[model samples]
Target: MKADPRGVLTGTHFLDGDHACCEGALAAGARFAAGYPITPSTEVVERFASRVPKVGGTFIQMEDELAASITLQGAVWGGAKAFTVTSGPGFSLMMEHIGYAAMTETPCVFVDVQRGGPSTGLPTLPAQADMMQARWGSHGDYEIIALCPNSPQECFDLTIQAFNFSEEFRVPVMFMMDEVVGHMTEKVIIPPADQIEVVPRRHTRKAVEDYLPYGTNGDGVPEMAHAGEGYKFHVTGLTHDEHGYPNMTPATQDKLVRRLQNKIHDAIDRITLLEEECFDSEDVVVVSYGITSRVAQRAIEMARERGLKVGKLRLITCWPFPEKRIRELAATTKAFVVPELNLGQMVREVERAANGKARTFAVPHAGGSVHRPEDILKVIVEASR
Candidate 1:
């Protein structure tokens, strides 16, 4: 294998998910990150701090999670590819900044290595309780991209995708990883930089006089103008217009907010990613994501061994919830079995999308560990029947 001129570590190696996440950010051209130390997630930035300097990147240890979250956005406005990392309470603290990122249309990433939650629940344990929070943690009417990785390799690959989505949509992206996936060690194959595809920031080419900070370039997403670029533009968390000025009128608010959301909602098909196994005529479909998807696989196999027609849908992009696909499957499948670390967060989405067409069963766990294969199998068996 040839060395990557871009300084990416291009090869296969045994690495835990947190470490692999750092490598992914690096490979994706993330040159700046701000983070505060937090369990199950600190390692992502810890590795980044150590490894980034060699690749011409910078990692700042912020005073707290809020600071860490906002700082990365500042970095983005200054023309750097940036992200931040946290878990549980830290993630909660960053909600305000997350909303600010949304309102300002900052292109950045936030990695949440989820542990058991509800305020300092379990620091070292695994849980998917943050799924809803990732979608709605910040108040308001906005859409954000979120990717769930069930393995170390995905941790590497999806982090890159996370940054790319942030750039493509000009929105903050949530890279949701449970503690199990964060700490679990596995082989990760990182290809050469030349093999990697990165989306460059959509910087405005129009003259400073011609640029509107929030103006679109055909696509709903506005072209960004970095600070110190001889272009003048304002950014605020409040409702703003094409010039990025704060405009509190209902009409301005309506137009700005709708554009912010429609840019994502309209392109849902392109943003969603899933790994699926279909049966010719399946009786049930098992829906899962992150580490729980791995556990669900075992349960799926157990049900299959018993001659059950159980299909699988593993969510790679959790947000922009794949309701269309779920609704389509609802028409044909008898039931949907969702097994997740939290007590039925995503199952609610499944239930809503199913719209009573098919029965829905949620196999929920409290999050110290993953669910037993037999427990999920029982649900799948029940759903099949």
Candidate 2:
């Protein structure tokens, strides 16, 4: 379906990532949001709360991050495309509900404007440290889509993708932004409503009598019925049968859990997104994402001027990790230099994918800010040699 013309802010304007994300969500048909304001991410829901009423939606400022996180899920089951925004501490509070969203096959979006942290480390500064936490913070076994936006332009573009992926796969999609991207202002061009294609919810066509909440036609993703649809269905976080009834059996566990993981695992190629530059020919590839990708671009330019065969791989979708691409590059590139705001999280994924076929270097930062071009260039030079 095309976006609503009324909601589409069709024009070019200077905006920051958080505001851009809010615009993207509105443009993509997100009519509901529940959030607790925190650090850099606060602007997202702030904009949503102010703008949503005009567009026929609801925005709730929950008492806490925990309420905000799960309240969005309730909105989703009630038949609205919903999302929430938070920073490090709020994100941590939302972990349990993230797992709940996964277990119940709830389609929702979680925006984490990452700040340096274990608890409340540098609440107003940037960090990519949450990369691992986004994947593993929720516990149990499941996969979720995670996208990183380096610019306000991408921040707008990728939030739509995040919602689409969530609806299509019936899974939570993580919109991982950093404090730098969230606060940094840039030009954002929002296109006309007709130009934007949106994925509508795959609501079931089945009659209420025959509907099985957990029943799949063929694909792993089951059809959904809204709460008031009279579908007579059930959904729970425990292991369940096709009818969505809790069943304490190994057979149910194996089938349900395996299918949940396999839906994403099998579609990794389609879900994975990367922005590549000269990687096919360059002996050294500098891999980075989010704000760090922009920083790495400068290093790539500097290395090229120095007559080095350096390439750039900017991860647009960080989770689902682009292992195949990295593995293929491992056979060609001499080394992979990963620069991140964290000490080294995603660099480990690059290294694991590269295995022993190529050397991998981590250019880590404890976060609070971005990496300097020279620091990444230094790693690129070393990797090239």
Candidate 3:
């Protein structure tokens, strides 16, 4: 076992998904954070608040979710990797800032431990209802990355991946978790600091006079200059020019928005991550993510036991929606069975991607609890037939 350093507890230990996520952020060099307290998601920042100071960082419990969301972006511009955690209604409160983060190309992470919700739906219970919200809750035409982790270990692993993706693309990355996964305890092994890979911020190498806060050298992502390093740069949410100044013209909006979306769209192949178990003759494919993926796996096994040919596709990266892969699979697969904790969220994506080439079956759950394996298996059996 490697010795623990600064914030890395470098060994195996039992941890809930929230704690593991905090450790992942620390390991990924998140030196600052700001968040408001909310159930199922509060422990992530509670641990962060306790751990960050020892590592020469800061964690501020902001007045509300909106303040917490924007404060982290301030920390990011000040040259620190940062994040915020929230659940349900709190997640809804942060939408405007999420759009701001996208407009300004802020590199930060938002850890949303989802719970049942229309308004204060189920604070302590599980739900995958936030899937579509993570992608489109924020008003705007910009793009962001979102990841779903089904276990404690993945909660640790994918949070680091989330931070890395944010820095790499200079966009906000959503770390989506459900209450069940967030509170589920399991063994999570933390690697030594030296062994962990952290993506450093893409600071500008140009002289102060030569740097433009939003100026890019061809690849849509711009080099960032710290807030107080004698770099005169502007940051705003309006349609902006390369200099980060408000332009507010149709031409500017078209150019800016398309670049924001295209930077991600062009790189979708590299960004999408999935775990698959498939056979050439499998007729039904179970498409799922987050904690529901685990439930779907059990259902898939039961279907196979009945001599049914079934495959599993677990989404580790949910946003940007693996359209090409689903389209390709639809050509050969007989049907797709999408089971989610929400009444029907990601199944719509499956139906869209399948494009009628394959029949689509949805197994919807209304948030308080996960679907029974039999429920999912029944859908699989129906889809197969």
Candidate 4:
């Protein structure tokens, strides 16, 4: 389905990552948003709240992060493409609801503009520390789609994809942006609504009495029923039967839990999105994401100048981590230099995937700022050797 032209700001404009994300959400048909404003990411909801009225949508400033997190789910069930935006502290508060969104199979989106922290650390600085939390912060066994946008341009582009993935998989998709990217300003090209292709909501066609909210078709994603539409579908945060009623049996638990994990695990090949450059003959590869990817490019160039054959693997989709591609590259590459704005979260995944097929090194940064190109180049040069 093409976007509604009314919501699309179809032209080029100089915009920050946060504003670009807001524009992207508007373009993707997000007509409702609920969020407790927080730093770096506040601009996202700020723009949304200001623009939603113009685009025929609603924006609610909930009391707190928890309310904002779950309220978006209510909006989704009410048949709106809805989401919330947050940063470090608020992201922490939203974890429980993230679990709830996963358990109930609620189709929603979470825009987390990351900052340095365990607790209110560096609210204004950039960091990618939440990468692991996006995958495992929510308790229990469940899977979600997470994307990292590297620039204001990608911030615009990937925000649409995040909504599309959430709708397609019937799960909350995380748009993991960082403070730098969220605040950085760049030229963003928003094409006409007709030029953009969007995935329409998979609304169930069955009658109210025939609907089975937990029942999935061949693709493992159950069709969603509109709330208050006479479908009378049930949604719960517990293990549920096909009818969406709580089912306490261990067997029921296994069935529901496994499906949640398998739906994403099975689609890893199709869901994993990454960009590789100069990998054909490079001996060392720098794997990074979000704002860090841009910083890594400088390191890649520096390594090249020093006679190091370096390539780059930028993770466009962070979760459903590109294990296969990493494993495949491990076989041919001499090593991988992972530079992250955190203390080596994703680098561990790289090491595991490499499985000693090739060595892996980390150029860890303790958040407040990004890595210096020469710092990453040092690691790249070491890995090259």
TM-score to true structure, per model: 0.98, 0.99, 0.98, 0.98
Q: Model 3 Cα displacement at 61 (Å)? A: 0.6
The residue ranges of model 2 lying beyond 4 angstroms of the native Cα positions read none
Error of 4 at 65 (Å): 0.3
Give a tens-digit lDDT track for model 2, residues 311-335.
8888998997898998888888899
Candidate 1 Cα RMSD (Å): 1.7
| Model 1 CA deviation exceeding 4 Å by range | 1-4
Worst ten in a row by lDDT for model 1: 1-10
> Per-residue lDDT tens digits of candidate 1, residues 255-314?
989998999999999999999997775899999999999999998888889989999999
lDDT score, candidate 4: 0.91
Q: Estimate, for each residue in 144-199, the C-alpha lDDT of model 3 and write its tens digit.
A: 99999999999998998999999989999999999999999999998877777777
